[model samples]
Target: MKNRTKIALLLLSSFGLMACDVATNTSPKTDPNTTAQTAVVSEASSSDNVTKEKVETTKAEVVMKAKTTSDGKLILGEQEWVYIPGLKESFKARVDTGATTSSVSAVDIQPFERDGEDWVKFKIEHDGINSDEIELPVERWVKIRQSSAEGTQRRAVVVAWLQMGDYKAQTEFTLADRTHLTFPILLGRSFVNGVAVVDVSQKYIQDKHKE
Candidate 1:
């Protein structure tokens, strides 16, 4: 009778142990494909997070373009631009820091040889305030350095009449088809030298920023 009782207790204990093990092992048995799918999903989630972060960082860096300045002068960069309130049109330009002269855009720079003197005839949009074309006469074609995206460059040039900020300055500019450039007029050292000092790190020094 004691042996029967001992056998019954042993059987019950063995069954309890089996039940505990089964309960502990209840994690759904997964195939290799399921495990791989889980890993892929996790990896894709991580990649998506990283991609979003990169896009946000790039957008933050692309704030409005800052204008160029140096000391008290406004230094124009190679392809900086400014709005002429008088002309009502934006002039894309390549700024030449090395040139002693500045230039404006003109079309049909034709050479008219007379009395062994060389003169270029061109059409100035002239403030572009009026659709009426103004014929501007050139004095001479002088060699000047033109600043470009590449570097400071030398080129043949001519002069034109331009008004900047209540100041009527005789600006010397090469006749350029600057329809493709950023600013239509190249503000060389001659145009900016004694007039205003350039402060390279600032743009639109006259404007206020909203926080």
Candidate 2:
């Protein structure tokens, strides 16, 4: 009878051990998406303002093929002309990735002083489509570059504040006749510096239909 009792106790202990093993061996149950989201949040928190300031780009070198302006105008890499919403028309323009100043075609360039400050008054046919009337603005002119244009063709231009797709930049444009050119707006290297990167292979990535 003692031997039977010992056998019975051993069996009970063995069963208890098996039960403990079963409890500890249970698999972890958690949502995969939740786990991934947590990891993403952690990574974002760890990184500095660099992650928060600009649009998140892929790990692989991201080339901005196309982008839209703050005014919702679509633009492409190295696109020559951009539609001005205010004018409701397209102008002849060029994208000069090397030029540091934005050049606009202007004619009848004149300068004057207003309110005891230097200002310029020039006329440009707003958008080559709708209005025939010229856009005349008298704004303060700051000479940032003396020899901005190509070689001996240096131009004196006025600086204006420009907004492109949540990016604001001051660009210098000259009043010159660019009517002969295919595009009226010349986006110089200066304008493209920080706001854009040129993909020489890609053109008109934004609006395919635009000329």
Candidate 3:
């Protein structure tokens, strides 16, 4: 009887070991494809984050560059507020790259001789407002062909100090009647050359002149 009991105990032990082995073998195993897919998703997410950071950095740089120039010149827009020292007031000015010479609104323009030098007297008039009579030495005279008229009209040019933003310089301006024009002053390439760059799409890019 003792021998038979020992044999039955051994048989039970063997069966238990086999069952454990079967359970271990049948247990759910990790799918290699699923692990690979997870790794790929993680890498893609990391790559997307890096791309977003780069894009944001590029956009910020573009914005900063738009407000400034690489050559340390003012960035002018289609229109700007220019301060004329002679008039002691700021006026709206049109920035025209197509024009070769600047012009200012003037009326009662008369040319005379002063101390044996050519001089001109005029009053700035625009938009129903008129300035005091100002006399300046004539720098030169130019005849501009009118788009509406068949003949050319003569105008006197004078050197005037003008301030736009932080830039101040003396430039030549042709005296002409501009009461019907939108802006009293027209800035041309002569004024903008080496002083600023024109961005026709923008307006008032520079701060208004003060004092």
Candidate with the greatest lDDT versus the true structure: 3
Candidate 3 per-residue lDDT over residues 1-211, each given as its tens digit: 9999999999999999999999888968899999999999999999999999999999988865564588788898899988987788889999998999999999999999999999999999887668999999999889999899999998899999998766778999999988888999999999888878888888987777776
* lDDT of residue 148 for candidate 1: 48
Candidate 2 per-residue C-alpha lDDT over 1-211 given as tens digits, one digit per residue, 9 for 90 to 100: 9999999999999999999999999997899999999999988886755764454564322545336545544444566345554445555455776765567666665666666765555556433543333433444343443464654543456665544444445666665556666666778766665556655565655442232
How close is every model to the real structure, measured as TM-score? Answer: 0.42, 0.47, 0.69
Worst 10 residues of 3 by lDDT: 63-72
User: Which candidate tops TM-score?
Assistant: 3
Q: In candidate 1, what are the lDDT values of residues 22-139, reduced to their tens digit?
A: 9998997779998999999999999999999999888766533322333334434345444443344444444566765666666655666566766666554444422224334455
TM-score of 3: 0.69
Compute the lDDT of residue 181 as modeled in candidate 1.
50
Which parts of model 3 are misplaced by more than 4 Å? 1-68
Q: Comparing 2 and 3 by lDDT, which wins? A: 3
Error of 2 at 22 (Å): 66
Regions more than 4 Å wrong, model 1: 1-95, 114-117, 124-134, 143-156, 206-211
Candidate number with the higher lDDT (1 or 3): 3
